[model samples]
Target: MATAPGHPIDVHTWSTPNGWKIPVMLEECGLPYRVVPVNIGRNEQMAPDFLALSPNNKIPAIVDPDGPGGAPIAVFESGAILQYLGRKTGCLYPADERARVAVDEWLFWQVGGLGPMLGQAHHFRIYAEEKIPYAIARFTDEARRLYGVLDRRLADREHVAGDYSIADVAILTWAKYHEKQGVDLGPLPHVRRWLDGVLARPAVQRGLAAI
Candidate 1:
């Protein structure tokens, strides 16, 4: 379905897990959007224009020309952006309070826990200038534990939060880089299964390719 006329939403992002979420959400919502690349490696996110949109100087912020009350609005943070798009389109985010709560639980889990710990793991294990054994072990162990949690969560359900909501979308980008975090998926069969299923979605393919 072609999106409605007028300015497409502007997605200011880079090619990273956090950056991938907004474009993925926009694609899944079928919302018209255009990507404005922010190369963090070159500190482009610190540009005055980009900072005006995302005060935190983070990738994956957005400007919606058609926003609440038909006024333009800029949104920062991947999780917040996902929730906003979900609510705006009335898609993955369930209207039922209970169902929404479940989704929120997992969404926050990814944004707050899974993403951070795994990021630390990635830093220490792969990107750190001087790798500290303790830091590497600590985060890698934590990454393993988090994957175990996700594995068990998917043992019965096909997706996180009882459905393929933004929770899965949020987690998938980070989880997709399991190898970089010094974690193996062999022991986590359920997570491997869930990952395969989510990756197979056409919307997910398009979203991941948006970079």
Candidate 2:
């Protein structure tokens, strides 16, 4: 469905995993919203208009015209955006308190851990064009170690926690890149299974699309 004029939402994003988390959930919940791609590679985030919405000049910010008080709510952080949409749509984030926290824990784990580690690794290993051995080892090892942490946590669960909540949605697309880096999945049987579960979600597929 198309978002009506003065649509409830306007999402600024790139086609990144961090970027896709919100859209995937929005699409999954069938929410009507608009997408405004932020070309981070071209320094578009530095523009005055984008910076006004996201002072940090980041992608994945959102403006909700029909927010809690019917005022446009500008949200910057990806996790914050996910939570905002969850409360608005009443899905993705679990309703039960304990389950919700568990999901949030994993979300934080990725946002604070896996995402940064892998991003650094990608910077030095792929984008830099300079070998930068120390940086590569530092990032790649951290990414591997962090993946181990997740692999261990997933040993007994199908998803990151009890149900398929924002936790899974937050981290899935990013983790999908591990295989391309020669990161071993053999030791992470549980993580692999968990990933399979996440991959099966229709929302995940829709979210990863180049919007």
The best candidate in terms of lDDT: 1
**Which regions of candidate 1 are displaced past 4 Å?**
1-6
Residue 155, candidate 2: Cα error in Å is 0.9
| Position 56, candidate 1: lDDT | 90
TM-scores of all candidate predictions against the true structure? 0.96, 0.92
* Candidate 1 positional error at 157, Å: 0.6
CA RMSD for every model?
Answer: 1.4, 2.0
Tens digit of lDDT per residue, candidate 1, span 1-211? Answer: 2165667999999999999888777778888889889999999999999989999998889999999999999999999999998998887899999999999999999999999999999899988999899999999999999999999999998888876899999999999999999889999999999998888887888888888
lDDT tens readout by residue for model 2, 1-211: 2343446478899987788877887777777778888988898989999999999887889988888877668999888888888887788788889988898899888888888778787778888978888888888888889889888888887778777788888888788888644478888888888887788777677667737
Q: Model 2: how far is 72 from its true place, Å?
A: 1.9
TM-score, cand. 2 vs. native:
0.92
Taking all chains together, the TM-score of candidate 1 against the true structure is: 0.96
- Model 2 spans with C-alpha error above 4 angstroms: 1-8, 180-182
